[model samples]
Target: MIRVNHRSGGVLVLAVTETRLTAAVAPQFKQLVLDQIEAGNTRLVLDLSEVGFIDSTGLGAMVGILKRVGSRGDVAVCGLQPAAAQMFRLTRMDKVFRIYDDADAAVGALEQS
Candidate 1:
């Protein structure tokens, strides 16, 4: 299951709770995130602390979300568990998205960028 917790303060934080972010579920999650981004939201922080794994589809979903926000906005990820964090590193996505230890750090990174 995937759960996105939305927060304010010029930053929209999405907390994902799922064993895997694979093709089976990435699309739905992508749409949900897209909806949030389109709703006048600019800064975003995706918290993957509870997500145990992420497949290529999940990576693609994140890339799509980043594109949706574009350079006009910023999107960072936080709290990625070890497994998911490894995948990001393997795919070089860790370099793509600004990653931090927690939501506050991500928000700070984005604000500073």
Candidate 2:
């Protein structure tokens, strides 16, 4: 589940409500974002501030989302909890996605793009 907020300049901020993003939830999470993309929301800021843990499956889902958006739009991540941040770093996914300290910064950057 995600809390959706529509910001200016066609930016969509999706705050993940789950504490753990693992195999059990990755599929649904991926689908939800894909659905949003299908609905014309290309610019996205995925707020993972509330997600304390993320597994390989979760990371895969995020990657899938970014690939889905491709060159048509951007997908940035913000407010990563320590564990999630570490995972991103360890996997070097930090380089794959735009990361920000908070939703505002991510949204601003996406809006500018």
Candidate 3:
């Protein structure tokens, strides 16, 4: 499951409450982002602090979500655990996504621009 909260500074924070992000939830995650994009929000912050694991499909879903935002806004991911961080580095996705140590930092950084 996921929780999306719209905050000040046009930042929509999506918190992954589940322990793992995999094929099972990738589609739902994508759908959630899509729904928001269609509602006209692109500035997004994904809170992954609670997430314990992520697979390739989950990674792909994240990429797709970012693409959906396009150049209209930005995407930031925060609270990556050690394993998830390693997966991101291995795939070089760390370079693509703006990563933060916490939700406040992610929202602060993105809200500025």
Each prediction's TM-score against the native? 0.89, 0.99, 0.97
Q: Summarize candidate 3's per-residue lDDT along 1-113 as a digit string, tens digits.
A: 77988889989998989789999998998898789888988899999999999999999999999998889899999999998999999999999999999999999999898
Which candidate number would show the highest TM-score if scored against the true structure? 2
lDDT of each: 0.84, 0.97, 0.92
Counted clashes in each candidate structure: 0, 0, 0
RMSD (Å) per prediction = 1.7, 0.5, 0.7
> Which residues of candidate 1, in runs, are more than 4 Å off?
1-8
Task: Sort all candidates by lDDT, best to worst.
Answer: 2, 3, 1
**Cα lDDT, model 1, residue 88:** 88
Q: Write the per-residue lDDT of candidate 1 for residues 1-113, one digit (tens) a residue.
A: 44655554677788776778889989988888888888877788988887888988898999999988998688999998888889888989889989999988887777676
Candidate 1 vs candidate 2, TM-score winner: 2
Model 3 quality (TM-score)? 0.97
Mark the regions of model 2 whose C-alpha exceeds 4 Å error after superposition.
none
| Candidate 3 wrong stretches, greater than 4 Å | none
